[model samples]
Target: MNQPRPIFGTTIFDGSQARKGYALNRMCFSFNDAANRAAFKADEEGYMRSYALNEQQSAAVRGRDVLGLLAAGGNVYYLAKFAGILGLDVQDLGAQQTGMSKEEFKARLVRQNDQPAATAG
Candidate 1:
């Protein structure tokens, strides 16, 4: 038997997840069009309906919960479009995903970059 995957407080976007999130991701991809983005801004509910999102996906979108969205199988790249609609960027999503405040996440990134890589002896 295969071992269970560890929970790292983040969802892995696997094949199952991709299938589950197809509608949501496709809807997000539509946001690439200016008109579609404008339409979404004009009518959030109608826009969601157009995508035929399931209750869980719809709920996640309404709540603006990044973690919830991930749990609902939302792909990060596609969800970036959705987040952009709310004036949030990847850093903001990263903060939400990692359960850190934006400032804390930024600080962490800086610290990580400052660290020297291990040299192979």
Candidate 2:
């Protein structure tokens, strides 16, 4: 069997991670509904418990630690629902992924955009 390759800074969401994150992803999926989102907002710990999230998953959620969530087997798509509840955007996630502040990430993006596109030889 082929082993999964390791990434330097983040976890790769694959079949194993999917199985590990099933409950967490399911709970995040529920956030698609306003009622469910409101319920989570009203009672964060209770909501997580109701979903049967593991300790690591619960801790990541509580810390708002995006990288930690990924390590805990979270899928970004499902996590996006949770992020929405926190009023975060993809840039915020990107910042976390790169270990930079949101403003730093945005500045990096701007700097990259200002670079001229490379041409094929």
| 11: Cα error in model 2, Å | 0.7
Prediction 2 global C-alpha lDDT? 0.95
Of candidate 2, the 10-residue stretch with the lowest lDDT total is 3-12
Question: Model 2 over residues 62-99: C-alpha lDDT tens digits?
Answer: 99998888888899999999999999999999998998
For every model shown, the clashing-pair count is 0, 0
User: Scored by CA lDDT, what does every candidate get?
Assistant: 0.93, 0.95
> lDDT at 1 for candidate 2?
100
Q: lDDT (0-100) at residue 23 of candidate 2? A: 94
